[model samples]
Target: MAEITLVEAVNQALAREMSDNKNVLVLGEDVGIDGGVFRATAGLLDKFGDERVLDTPLSETLIGGVSIGMAAQGLIPVAEIQFMGFACSTIDQILNHAARIRNRTRGRLTCPMVLRAPFGGGIRAPEHHSESTEALFAHIPGLRVVIPSSPERAYGLLLASIRNPDPVVFLEPKRIYRLVKQEVPDNGEALPLDVCFIIRPGNDVTIVTWGAMTHDSLVAADKLAEQGISAEVIDVATLKPLDIETISVSVEKTGRCVIVHEAPLSGGWGAEISARLAEHNLFNLLAPIKRVTGYDTVMPLFRLEDQYMPSTDRIVGAVNEVLKFE
Candidate 1:
């Protein structure tokens, strides 16, 4: 029960799963020799050996294809793409094959693979490294998109994803890789998927967010609390099969909602949550739903990077605006 960062928790989960399940394997660029771009797979090579941990050439598309093949053949391959920007090439294999394998084979084959990538901005990385295009994967019917906000959830949710019998996109928030630490037990237990975790309970407003944005959202909630505003915060662990029920119940009680995300605002996952709330919890709302998100533009360089991402001030502003309606 040592305190660990989010990235360390991820490594613990992978090691535990690979040790318990011989079929679990890890493959990706620099995953074996170098451990990984961010070293999320650090020290796994010695522990699991080359057969279980492979370092593939720098080709995301190849990694995706190979992982799918291994999965169909009964191996649980946890493939990693160094960065989310590089993962774009894997869309062909992921969308057309991995996602549809089980349905296409009519249950004869199930693609049990976990595609891992470090996503989101805040590290001031160059172009492409800061992409937060989770909505793209979430739109794919057969895929499950999961993003963890803290070390505990990262450890638990990743275990669940690896054990799942379907293809899962496990997007790690690189921004918060070492932002904070939590006492995470290496118990091999997993958190349930397709559900939301209400990290903070309140009654005035519901602040919905995931990934790195969860950090800022929680900060905003604290700021609101000082002002006598009790803001509930929901960490949407699984985005695709969204646990709207948890969100709806929170909104129903709070009667106000503010969705947050690092992705550009036009069609980010926040929009999907907003739509679901409006459709089902319209009458319960006291104020119009608001979204505090990134602008509809490319993630800028270091100078403008902080400005582009949603901030605690912005979240509080949105909550205040919604509160004004009441």
Candidate 2:
């Protein structure tokens, strides 16, 4: 029950799984000797030895191919891409082989692999270091895209992803990796996948978000509370196979909805959620759905990072806009 940050919680989950399951192997660039670029895999190599914790070449394609090969042959591989921006290089293997293996083999085989990467902007990282292109994987059929906003969720969701019998893209928000800490129990309990968690209960508006945006959304909720506005916050932990029912139910009660994300506005996952609400819960809304999101441009460098990312002011403003519909 030690207090740990999101990154440490991730390390705890990997260690627990690797210790409990001998077939679980960790592979990625600088994962072994270097303990990963963020040190999420720190100390794993020494505890599990080189055979279990392997250090691969700095090639995302090779890492994807090798993990898929290992998974098909009965080994459960948890592969890590150095950064979300670099994950595009491995999309071919992921979209083709890894995602289609179960259907291609007609249930004879399952791809139990977890692809982990740190994503989003805020840490003043250089180009190709910060990317929130989660929508790409979420659009792909048969792939489960999961993002955790807190240390507790990171621990549980990651364990669940590795145990899942399908390919899963586990994106970690690096900005919040060590921003907060929580006393997460190291009991090896895996949380449910494809579900949304209600972070706060309210009746005025439903605020939907995931990953690092959850932090700002919660902060906005608090600010709105001071002004006598009740905002319900929903953390869409499992982006793929989205739990729209949970969101729909919340929107029904709140009568207003505001979606938020760090990804650009055009094709962010927030659009899909907005579309679903309109399709199934159109009559229940009191106002048009609003989305507070990043601009449709490349993530800027350190100087402009703060402006590029959505802030509490934007979220509160969206809530206020929706509340005016009545």
lDDT by residue (10-88, candidate 2, tens digit) is 9999999999999999999999988999999999999999989999977999999999989988999999999999999
lDDT of 1 by residue, 1-326 (tens): 56999999999999999999999999999999788889899999999999899989878899999999999999999999999999999999999999999999998999999999999998978888998999999999999999999999999999999999999999999999999999998999999999999999999999999999999999999999999999999999999899999999999999999999999998889899999998999998999999998899878886898899999999999999999986
lDDT against the true structure, per candidate, is 0.95, 0.95
Model 1 C-alpha RMSD vs. true structure (Å) is 0.7
Please give the RMSD to the true structure for each candidate, in Å: 0.7, 0.7
Give each model's clash number.
0, 0
Residue 58 in candidate 1 has what lDDT?
A: 77
Task: Report the C-alpha displacement of residue 206, candidate 1, in angstroms.
Answer: 0.2
Question: If scored against the real structure, what TM-score would every candidate get?
Answer: 0.99, 0.99
- List where candidate 2 sits over 4 angstroms from the true fold: none
Flag regions of model 1 displaced more than 4 Å: none
